[model samples]
Target: MKLEDLRGRLMAVDKKFKEMYEGLERNKIKSIIYDKMGKPVSLKKLSGYEIENITEKRGIVGVDGSINSYGGIYPHYISLIQSMAKSTLPKEEDIILQDVYVPLFEDEDGQAEDELKRRARMSKLELQAASFAMESFSSKVIFMDGSLMHYGIDCPSEWKKFKEKAISTGKIIIGITEEVKTKDIAEILKTELNLNDSILYDREVLFGILNEGEMLEFRRDLKSKKSESGIKSCYVRLSEDPQVAGLDFIEEQYVEALKYADLIYTLTPEKGRGIPLWLDIVDKEVKVTDEMVKSLVESTISREIREMLLNPKRSKRG
Candidate 1:
């Protein structure tokens, strides 16, 4: 396409966006009037709580893993490295956990070629580790790195059992996601409230709707076909970066959910990007570097086997 054509398309999109913004404003006014009638409101401003008021016990645990596969040889192999961080606050201390698993590919019925199994193994490990921490600690809040909703239809019973155990222990399991794709709230606004133009992702619609240290709760119906996990979520803005994140918690734990959100906001640095420092520490501990992979392969494999391994032409040239 020519540069002039691209420029024209960009200008058209800008005009469309302006029209959509005006429509949204009009819908907000209608929503306010409807809210006064005591109807079901999807979004509301949160007040009466400040970040300085957050003084609760928090025990945060994060799990992440890395995988590397070598498929060029006769016997394929994969190296999986997993790490977990357990942190207790008020007096911050982190206990690090690490493990490595090496699986040899047998090529039996093509099962060895499936990558999803590897991913599932990592997920299962992470969940189990987090569950153990939840059971061992008496902290009011327990944190995880991703969604608590298990989307895998084929997930094992143990995975569900661990989550149940954590919740049954009366500790709040909070999942903080940097990126979210859920459209449940947006769908609710369109279907129940008859707002047609608000068909964007939940985060996009809530981009600037929340102020710093404020969170908007979203309740999902367990019987709704769209809600597979029956989990309740909220959108929170932790800093002044104009970025919002989705926080998922169990539906029955509404009051605890609000407190957990405030605690996260309190821990978030005011000057840096909006994320808790403990999460950052765990993320760095679990990340796998290329040098680490090279060292693992060199130290584990014999020199003869290393030479027998195949290398791509470009890698060999370098």
Candidate 2:
């Protein structure tokens, strides 16, 4: 019962969850197509959703970040056009991909720690904004910028609603993560369902391409951490059974996931190039760039903080 033993046990369980999920759910997969503008016109049509924005609430929002580095606010939009799916393959010609912009903000309090608190705050703001848009236009679906579990931890209200609806429909909600571990989604599911262990699996999933140069930054960070102290691990883990498939499988696997959706679009930032998610069938790296993460971080609390600062809190002591 040592602390390290317990931590190692948790990590082992995390690995087991990921391996199990990937092993079980690789066959059921689908994909989506979008245009350069980040609009899912082709996907909406493919999913049998109204192409003309028939629902007053049909649209995707991209977020990005603005940082005051060197005393100047630098706003960067994570940019990219993406297509998603579960088991079905997209006709290369039919894929009209679009770029989305999402912002990630800097955590004023924990910037020194490089804490991912911004991800939480930005996710909450994005959900709030998306929810307001949904209410304003009475939209049927809101394609959030990232994975479902990220939102659950960041914005519990929307996550609860999303889970209830997706489960009621017998639909597995798809979550895309710039980071690969499935821990966020699994945690949310376990908490929501109150299950000590439940079987979930990854269907057809695709990992976008990454070259050595593309991963250099990650290498540097990893190397730096090798000699650093007080560095907490952010590595995530999940439980799902997935099957192994080739890149060609992307079309076939994602198509199935698409069948469950009325519309499929990218609600993530364009910066990181694209957002990556786990595919049980493919046993390789699926890369979404850092640009996208930056976007969501930026958009999270920019306006809200400004407004809050302007409206000072009433003090009881005063």
Clashes of each: 0, 100
Which whole-number lDDT from 0 to 100 does residue 228 have in model 2? Answer: 40
**Model 2, 127-201: lDDT tens per residue?**
444334333432243333344445555666765664454434433333333334333223433444354466432
Q: Per-residue lDDT of 1-318 in model 1, one digit per residue for the tens?
A: 469989999999999877665544535633642343113223222333543233232445554444555424323454545656466454644444444543443334354444555666666666666666675654656667766564233255765676577668876777777676777555654555466755566556556655676665544332333244546666667777667776777666655665656567666776656666667767777766767777777777786765555333345564
Q: What is the model-wide C-alpha lDDT for candidate 2?
A: 0.32
Task: Name the top lDDT candidate.
Answer: 1
- What's the TM-score of every candidate structure? 0.70, 0.30
Candidate 1: where are CA atoms >4 Å away? 1-77, 89-113, 150-156, 188-199, 219-227, 303-310
- Candidate 2 stretches with Cα past 4 Å from truth are 1-114, 155-179, 183-262, 265-318
Which RMSD does model 1 reach against the true structure?
5.9
Worst 10 residues of 2 by lDDT: 31-40
